[model samples]
Target: MTLYQKLKASGNPQAVAQITISLLESHSVKETAKILGVTPRWVYKLRERFRLSNGDISACIKKRGPKFRMPNRTPEHIENLVVTLAKETNLGSKRLALFIKNTFNIQLSPFTIRNIRRRYGIHCRKHKTLTGSRRFATDFSAFEPLQLWQIDAKHIADQSALPPEAYASIFKNKLPPFQFTAIDIKTRLRFIAYADSLDFKNGLTFMLLVAAWLRAFGVKHQLFFQTDNGAEFGGSAGSRKRKLIQKLIFDHWNVSLLNIPERNKETNCFVERSHRTDDEEFYALNLKKVTSRTSFLKMAQNWILYFNYRRPHFGKNMNGMTPVEALKFYRCFYHPAIGSMPVVVLDQLSNYTSLLFDISSLPWDNLPRNKKLLNETMAHYRHSIFSTSL
Candidate 1:
């Protein structure tokens, strides 16, 4: 077979371009077209392109389709927005699509978003599967807001996840080293506090503050706070300190502090999962912006507010609702301020001697009548002591 016939069978663009260039040089357009088993019009078009490219062989190759972009193609700006959101949130295609629609009022299919992610080599990290037996098969789907909360402490000074500037700033500015996180399993409402250390006192203080904040916001249900058996949280079974702290929380707020089984992370999965998000969305992005402990708390407060009031959660049973929205959807009665609860420094709160004394001495029998007093007291600390310290 001839060169054209050989290449026509394979349909190689480079080979066709080379053959077209060579044949056009030695033969007329019609003769070249006849030899190449193509139309004279095609030969004429190739010759014009070749001449325009100064006899470049690549210019002679016919593209597989139209030269112009498809009319249905996503806009460049939209693609750029998608990429920006992908890097910022690291969310999956479906979640990303939902966010775009909700935030920007733009509609995009998940498949289109997935294609954009694939094209840009962006990928969401895959989490490891839980292999060991779960301690409880309890379905949390039926749980209501404040009925179940998962609390955990996460070290925020991770060198690997933080940028060098942020890592240096952590020590330079004496920023809090640990973050105490609490998430309501039902609405995914989260609260956070920072601490200089992960000691038992700080942990107990954090739990009490979270409980007080919840109760202040009309969360009157019996709250269950689940946590891993960390030393800060009273340690494993048979530990005296753990029992003491548990009793303190139970006595103060009627909150039940349940310790998850040792070595099984899946039990406290909600709070544990929130840690990864904290690393990705909060610490990694905002740490460098923190010039002082005050600034860090401000940023932390804003971040938690954004998470609860604005950011959409697409997790199981959440259905693309923000925590605040989820509360409303579930018909759970809660104050809107619950979503914007003040972020406090645990060490500061723990060390406030008079405040601690007041909390401990407050009459539990008259709690209903003292609700306004309790709210005023905490608000005073948040505005006066916490503000001054910051």
Candidate 2:
């Protein structure tokens, strides 16, 4: 039979693929197309499509009609039951179909139930499944500052309505809404940077900034950066930015990168909890204030300061102290393995320095003269008297 007759009889993409393969083995594209009664361009297109789809024969098929539909033979009462269970209990299609079979003595396929739910726009209905997740205490945060850091980014809605500028093409302005975040596990001290976009490149940039900031505090212990297995973090495709990070941050600074299990947020519990706090306190309160990209960024920086230095963290470890307070606690105490640092005071300007840290990053430059120096003689020598409160 002719090639057209063969394709018409089989009426399957696989058949087309098989015939194409046979023809290509013995003939050129032009000859194959001539034999098939189609243009040579069509043959080349099919070849490319096959290559891109990795020779999946089904890729050659013409797409057929109608994605979703409730079966016509299904009774109206069964359809109603599917919708009712979906809305009330949020049972899945199979379970709902089984319920219909048992209670109403009606046999409804899961497909029929799924189609019925889809018809009423309830197909995406979800109910919580029993999981092993629970609130639990962990001893993983016993390290000194910079020994461990958790990094992650959260996305907010883009509220900007303005159009692009004329010179914005080469360096075009399109700001994506993302809040790149990092936290010291032991101190609960955090770093949050707002950015217009978030990708692997942006993630690496945030890490560099965070490391530099941490270095300024003299907390330059070899650190482990824990993050989820996101494409941006773990790296994917052509530009494996994670590899570059391994060479730059990990190799250079003696830091390491770690990935928690896929979809296992609990493994990266500290950052996840901080994100919840941001949702409750930051985003919910300031969403309306984010009129422009610039304004939103300023607001985000303020929130980060409040979170790290002002807002108290609750835990036995934290002792109702803010993150900076917790850091002071750690600097005086706590070791990686042996536990608790020596309280060796070299009698530097720590009193003035620590006070400077508390004055807020932005306002420190504009602070009154009296606040910058030791107005009072604060002693920390061995002979110096110590005071404590119960």
Which candidate tops lDDT?
1
lDDT, candidate 1, at 184: 88
lDDT of 1 by residue, 1-390 (tens): 765678867856678777888887789999998998888898788778888999787767766777898899899999999999998777888888998998899999999999989889999753333345554455866677668999999887877766677678888889889999999887899999888888877887888888878888788878888888898877875676666555654666788778887778888878877887877777767787888888988888889999999888888788889999988898986778878878888888897734654445533232477889999999987899777888
- Per-residue lDDT tens digits for candidate 2, residues 38-152, read 7888788778777888978678655667675536656777667678777874556765665566677888778878777777899542222235576535565466655788888
Total backbone clashes of model 1?
Answer: 1
> Model 2: which ten-residue window has the lowest total lDDT?
337-346
Please list the C-alpha lDDT of all candidates, in the order they appear.
Answer: 0.81, 0.61
Residue runs of model 1 more than 4 Å from their true location after superposition:
1-56, 64-91, 120-138, 353-390
TM-scores of the candidates are 0.72, 0.45
Best of the candidates, TM-score: 1
Candidate 2 segments exceeding 4 Å error: 1-132, 135-137, 158-175, 236-244, 332-390
